[model samples]
Target chain A: MANLVNYYIQFIKRDLQLAVRQKHEFVLPLLFFVLILILFPVTVGPESGLLARLAPAVGWINLILSLLIALPRMFSEDYENGWLEQVFLAAVSPSFFILTRILSFWLLYCLPLVICSVLLVPFMSLPFDIWWVLAQTLFLGSLLVAALGSVASALLVASRKGSGVLALLLLPMLIPALIFGSAVIEAAQQSLPYLSPMLLLAALAVFCLTIAPVAAAQAIKINLG
Target chain B: MFKWLHPYAKPERAYALANRLYLWLWPLALIGLFTGSLWGLMFAPSDYQQSDSFRIMYIHVPAAIWSMGIYMSMGIAGICALVWQMRSFELSVLAMAPIGAVFTAIALFTGSFWGKPMWGTWWVWDARLTSELILLFLYLGVFALFYSFDDKRAGAKAACILAIIGMINVPIIHYSVEWWNSLHQGASITKFDKPSIAKEMLWPLLINIFSCLLLFIALTCYRFATELLASESHRKWVTKIIQ
Candidate 1:
């Protein structure tokens, strides 16, 4: 049991180290998130009511799409570096490796977006009171994104052309998150009871957290073979 | 445990069994489908509210049910293939996807036709319809993922993972959409009242349901047989059968 914990820590450390080595990979999704925030107003025109109405959807979508941008790199880099093979052959189980990878990804890819979204909330002219709800939704919502994207990344690890198919596979599964995340903010904006949607989002995040890694690990084994 | 049934788990035995089953399934499917459609279209009473337009229910509802039913069956097959390493179940997943996709499409198309008259629009973001649309996309994802890999078995395993993921998501999608729909439309979709299903209307619907299910089974068996043959084409058994 101690050995498994050590292996888990080592995997997380290695992944965080790799993430830190290429700082831009971590920053790119954040940058993309910011860019979309700027671009939506330009494309849709600078009307505060429209932007306010669109804010929840725009924020949720950009977060999910930016997560997609970060996803393909999740497993492909390890596979290309031949690190995944070594990790699989080690005493650490694939599920643990995958779970740790998803955790690091949620930290690296999702956490920054959650923080940035809080800052971006004012720019969209959404009510300041809803900011906390928006932040909460973004935080929980993107964990589900990270978890589902992990499975997509694991499955597509060996494919040369993967990003397109990954989006197709992951986006449909991400709809619940999209619905709940945006709905929470929408509910809050309308002064309705928003707790239900928030709880649903957290539930979804937990469900994905438990199931995705094992499925992803199985996918990785299949892709490896 | 049915120990005596173990031999049927072999691909050759399964393939042979599927082939034998096809003989009865195909003719029964045809008869049921033709009679059910004819009876439902002509004999069954028109809905008092919608009249002739409601006849589309015979196709739309059955197609909707089978599309979801096929995906659920395929998901179960996927579990067997991935967890137990069953080749026949792998073949079952491969065979079921396209059929499920087609049924989903038929449901969507017929749904639009039905909606145009009932709702005075070609589309509504109703919960059932949106959920079925998402189901179509899920089926397409499995197809795309399965074919993307150069290694057939690897592709199957990858697709199986997706199938399992989708199975978990299906109910969540359905419930979420239902909630969203009710929030937006508010009690407009309570048309599925079980007590309102008169005996005259219910019998034809039941007949059509059975026919559609039989058709799905027949199509899946046929597709599974051909898929098995194609995959095992280089084997001695395949060559002997061809000879």
Candidate 2:
């Protein structure tokens, strides 16, 4: 068990190291998130009321787009460099490997989006309470997205046109998460009860965390075989 | 039984079975479809409120039920493929995609046709309609994923994973009306205590639903046979059966 913990920590460190090396790829999703958020204000006019009304939706859309932009490279780098096979043949179980990979992805891809969500909160003229709700929902929802992404990445690792097909398969499944997350923030803005949406978002996160690693592990075995 | 089932996992044997099955199914499907359609369209009583517009239930209800049923079937086929590593199961999943898509589309069209006369608009963001649209997208996504890969095995694996994950959406779609306050009426035919529809209406609805189910079975068998043949055209079974 201690060894498994070490493996996870090491995996995260290695991913962080790689992110440092490929700084451009790491920054691209952040830039895309900002650009997308900026589009709403420009397109919908600079009216504060309209922007506030659209804020939760804008944040949710950016969260999805950022995840998509970051998803293709989640496993491609290791798969291309033959590191994934090494991990498969290692002493670690496939589940452990998948869990570590998903955690690292959430840390790298989603954590930044959460920060960006905070930064963009003022642009949308969002209330403090709604901003808090958006932040919480984004954190949970992005974790779920990252878990689902690991499964998609593992499944598509060996396929041609894997990335595009991955997005097509994954984006539709992301709808419920998007709806729940955005709805929570929307509920907050209206000063209505936000508990139901938050609980739903958390349930989705738990569901993804429970099932995705196992599915992803199976996918990794299939790809390696 | 397992041994007997094992042999049919081979594409050729599956193809042969599907071919034989289709021969029996097509005739019965035609009989059921023709008989059901004639009865439902003409003999079924008109609604007290909506009149003949409720006749659309013959098509709408069956297609809606099938839209969910086919997804469940596809998900089961996917699980079977993953567990047994059967190529035939993968082919079934593939064949089910377009059939499921067609059923979902028919459900949506018939739903709108029913809705326009009843709801005074062709479309609304009501739970049933919204979820049905999502179901169509799910089918399209599965088909898109199936064709996206160059290798058949890899494609099947990816699509199987997708079908399994997307299964979560199915329950949400089915129960969306109950869970949320929506304009769409809850299940009238499927309820337990007593179905809301009268016996005169109920009989035709059941017949139509049965016919639709038979048609789906016939179509899936035919499509599975075609897929098996296409994928394994050079096999000895193909040479023996076609010639």
What is the C-alpha DockQ of each candidate?
0.77, 0.50
**What TM-score, computed on C-alpha atoms, does each candidate reach?**
0.95, 0.93
As for model 1, its CA RMSD to the true structure in angstroms is 1.8
lDDT of 1 by residue, B154-220 (tens): 8888888889889989999889888877776676654354347777777777888898898888888
lDDT of 2 by residue, A10-117 (tens): 888999999999999999999999888888899999999888888877887788878888887787778889998898888888787888888888888899888888
lDDT of 2 by residue, B1-243 (tens): 998787887677777788888898788877877777788889888878778987888888888898889999999999998988888888899989999999999999998887787777888766667678888888998888778767788787778877887786667544533344232345432212333888888887787788788888889999999988888889887878789
In angstroms, give how far residue B34 of model 1 lies from its true place.
0.8
Clashing pairs in 1: none
After superposition, which runs of candidate 2 have C-alpha atoms over 4 Å from their true positions?
B3-7, B172-195
